[model samples]
Target: MSKIKLLLAEDEPALGQIVKESLETRDFDVTLCADGQEALQTYTDHQPAIVVLDVMMPKMDGFTVAKEIRKVDDTIPIIFLTAKSQTSDVVEGFSIGGNDYVKKPFSIEELIARINNLLNRSLEQKNADTLKIGEYIFEFPKQVLRFRESEQNLTHREAHLLFHLYKNKNQVLDRSLILKKLWGDDDFFSGRSMDVFITKLRKKLKEDPAISIVNVRGYGYKLIC
Candidate 1:
């Protein structure tokens, strides 16, 4: 199998070295950069398979770097590595097409698992055919979401979660099942993260009165049609 290429952009030298070494030991080809500018430059030059970018940096912020990267390539996976845990920051990261986010002081094992999960999910999405949920039509290959006369462009996670729910439409999906399947974890934190995405999805599908993403207390969620 071909080795995965990873771009790790961190401001702290010690942390950067540690992450780089850990990834290399896992058989990944990692390119480490110290700031956002260099990270963007390296990304453009190397076109790594994935990127792990720090939010706060010297030259530029991680969100800015992510925007620059998205301008050049729309599909390469991006995982934000930041110390900020505020909901707004996380939402901003997702707005910029972030595939995942790893907070600072995080375990290397969790980081590796997230990287693998994101990559695997990206691959799976690339191979999906199509999915239909309630009144919405999800065309994975075309990357288009259609609902009646209104059509919305979705980010990667939106598409993935919608399709997965469609595949199991009308059934209640446990919180843990949805989390691990979509985000590689179902812990308290990931559970909260999933809630934000769920709210976003609900807003997008609000036009369809027949469709509902109901939260089942202590159980999971039901994508009712």
Candidate 2:
């Protein structure tokens, strides 16, 4: 099998080389960029399996890079490397679509472990096939929802959220739980994003009047058909 490609964005030259060499030793194909703008360009060109972004970088910060990446590919896993250990910083990372946050001076072994674990989880999610949701057939891998001859292609976030709701169809899912599961935190920003996704799902499913994602007031939501 081909080695997994990883995009590493770090402005520090010595650290960038060290990481690139280390990951190459472990059978990974690494594309190292020295600044955020270069990182973004490399990402667009390479489309690596995973992204490792340093929070402090020239041109743009990791947060900004993550936001831009999310606009194009929401499912690609992003790991933030930063010296900032503040709770707010961590929350902000997740809110911008980061899959994991690793502090600076982190052990390469631990970083590798986190990368492997996330890759495995992502792979498993991609392996899921079609699922029945009301009268619609959710094609998880394709990010498509189909009903009869009509179909709607969904964004990665939308498809992921809908998958969870369909999994618990007819059952109320706690709002906070869903937020934590998808966004890694239940903060206000993540909550608001979840609400947006819920609205999008409702709009997508509106073609089938019998299908409804009901808001459970102060609790959560339920997919009722």
- Name the best candidate (by lDDT): 2
Q: Which stretches of candidate 1 lie over 4 Å from their true place?
A: 71-75, 132-137, 146-152, 155-161, 174-225
- All candidates' lDDT scores? 0.82, 0.88
Give one digit per residue, the lDDT tens place, for model 2 in 10-86.
98899989989999999999999989999999999999999999999999998999999988776788999989998
Model 2 RMSD in Å is 3.5
Clashing pairs in 1: none
**Error at 218, model 2, angstroms:** 9.5
What is the Cα-based lDDT of residue 103 in candidate 1? Answer: 85
* lDDT of each residue in 1-225, candidate 1, tens digit only: 878999999999999999999999999999999988999989988889889999999989999999998776666788899889977687678767787888878999999999998888768766666666667777764557888787888776676677777666788877787775556566687788888888988998887789999988898888887
Q: Find the candidate with the highest TM-score and give its number.
A: 2
Predict model 1's lDDT versus the native: 0.82
Worst 10 residues of 2 by lDDT: 121-130
